[model samples]
Target: MRRRISMLAGVAALGLTLAACGGGGETPAEDSNAQDASGNVGVFTWWADGSEKAGLDALVKVFGTDYPDVTFDNLAVAGGAGSQAKSVLAAQLKAGNPPDSFQAHAGAELQDYIDADQLEDLSSFYTDNDLTAQFPADLVDRLTVDGKIYSVPSNIHRANVVWANVEVLKKAGIDPEKPAEDLEGWFADMDKIKATGTIPLAVAGSWTQVQLFENILLASLGAEGYNGLWDGSTDWKGAEVTDAIKAYEKALSYTNTDRDSLSDWAPATQLVQDGAAAYNVMGDWAEAKFAQDGDKPGVDYVYFPTPGTEGVFDFLADSFTLPKGAPNPAGAKAWLTTIGSAEGQAAFNKVKGSIPANTTAKTDDFSEYQKSAIADFGQDTIVSSLAHGAAVPVAWLNDLSTAVSKFGGDKDIDTLQSSLGDIGEKFAK
Candidate 1:
């Protein structure tokens, strides 16, 4: 999947953290003076908002109750997308005084930490706590490397969803319940939205917006063709891949923003919420914004899997890795274990509006559309992550972003297809 932005339209994006599941560990050296009867844990994350902070604080409250002696230093390092936090983490890890635990996404993101040998081995932690039986084998495997577990996934989020305003669809005389079934159907619906004077697709043409392009291509090409282009399994020059790129080019033309200077995702989010734009391609977490605005799913807003890949769920799971030389290694390992626990996942994601990574976590409070996502999680046909971020190297994905932005501006299918082919051919090596 692509990099996750805050799902709440007006709110800043929130990052994740790590904690252990079962119990106290011997306090590490950095926290030697900080330890008491309770395990002292230092956590670093990027969540900044009253509600988001409250939600996280609720997790802290739970942790405190379970481990009363545990002390916590909530470090708020603010910057968009953890740009500052990552830098601080690198320094701390190098200095051997890192936070007890920190955040990173699941999948390839964990590879770097594993290769650096900074993270504690959690194979024993997972087995002792029975986490292996709790989380899905695929998810466990994605977090595990070379027989060592370095991180614990916090939650699973579906990325390939189109959030549409129900009233806008109704105004366009389109059925809110049953969306267009295929790519042509998607265009027909968007055409109706445009005809109704609604921006067909709300978008910002920034690098991150390229994830939507990948989502659209995934729909057109299906998993095999899309993954092939990224993982060296398929030739990007093949007609099928070209056709997928062409489909994305056609969709790009329907975007609401001007090509010169695009709006940011927050404003694009507002455009859809305010009904100025009919739809926004975003992750399921964005539902939190709609809920905050007092909108009900299927009534005020409707979420549909991107057209043409209705049953194929594309997902991203959030995880936290212990940076090398973490200040509180034992506490960090404890945090990772906590993140993988069903209770902690459910508690954290409930406020965050994401599905718990542990399959056993109850999802009774999720909204109608979110419940649908929980159902999809049970099905084995889902792809773990989309190609834009975790599944492929960041360098290749950046190239794809450039190609997408070019397509968004030129609206030329041939040019876009050639660019994708060129990039794909190189990455396939």
Candidate 2:
């Protein structure tokens, strides 16, 4: 019960921005007429390739349909969770050339921008569009800071899904219908699959690897302990943290020998889809990749919460924020309107393989995988995603990513543990 309260407190903390921080430069005072707003609205994001692009295309189609005069500028820079793109975005924001609206994860990740005062309060925007009523109350709380909302979330994604190839599992004499109840059984199955002369697990570097670490932490430490890591309640140098790191090391062993060669997460998902690997633990967005290739769920593949996270929803969201000096405040507002609309949410999330942030968004036409995700999200113990910027701020995640990636290369559990402690000291203040 103590841990549960701590977890919720950490999540609630996302809604409170740094009070000490000041505002960004001069901004437009008037919001453009969303309906009558006619011009190019440059919405920048990190989804430039593969299935991610397809999801963006679906959203763009909706934007075009609703706002005919507003041209959607696809200013996407490809990187895992906007890794490479963020530095570029920072430069633009610093130079006062920020995009009209930009993609940001919907949790502590928004704190940096808010602290810099680069983001505009969307509270008015929400009231204007009835978005406050449309979005889940809990989600709205996370998106709000002080009394102001800074972004419009497009969709909620589960970060703890394991996508497996059905035929590959069958070939290894494993039942695709049954999900491994715990890591012991899951690793045993991976061992069996490894004996079949294939990569038992598929993974990529940087943020993807960090994501894998967080999932392992969730499995080894449970939701409370996992959430405790961010709040200093979980001892970074303790035996449990050590054990989770070792487990992460063991899991990395089953991954592809050429993981470094696999630059982006989709390629890792592709490995599973192509039957080169048996499983890929990734966000539900991987479902979008499989869907793009005409792969049917439960036939070509299957999804389950990452082993040991059966009833937990590892949550993250992709949202667009209106920058303070956005060249087109009207156009930014228009794009945000589409983002908050039930029709727009349905269109975007359907092709995106995620549940809409808007609770009232229709789901009758969604795929089986999406429906399952929606149901799980509705009933599960919700935890924030570290890799996707829900659990930690960007600086902390970036430093931790470095530690995790180096450990992936060196296999030094001690160094990794020490690095974690150093990071916790530096950031968990």
lDDT of each: 0.64, 0.82
- Give per-model CA RMSD: 5.9, 4.9
Model 1, position 187: C-alpha lDDT score? 89
User: After superposition, which runs of candidate 1 have C-alpha atoms over 4 Å from their true positions?
Assistant: 1-40, 49-55, 75-97, 205-207, 258-264, 410-429
Model 1 Cα lDDT, one tens digit per residue, 328-406: 5555555665676677777777776678878787778766776788777666246544332456544555577677777
Report clashes for each candidate as comma-separated counts.
15, 1
lDDT of 2: 0.82
Backbone clash tally (model 2): 1
Candidate with best TM-score: 2
What would the per-residue lDDT of candidate 2 be over residues 1-429, giving only the tens digit for each residue? 110111111111111111212122233635455765666777788888888888898889988988888777777777868877776677667666677788878788778777887777778888989887887777777676787888888998899999999999999999999979988899999999999998999998788999899999999999889888998889999999999998999999999988887777988998999999999999988988899899988899999999999989898888888777776777888888999899999999999889998988999999998998888777888889998888888789889988898898899999999999999988885
Among all windows of 10 consecutive residues in model 2, the one with the lowest summed lDDT is 1-10
Candidate of highest lDDT: 2
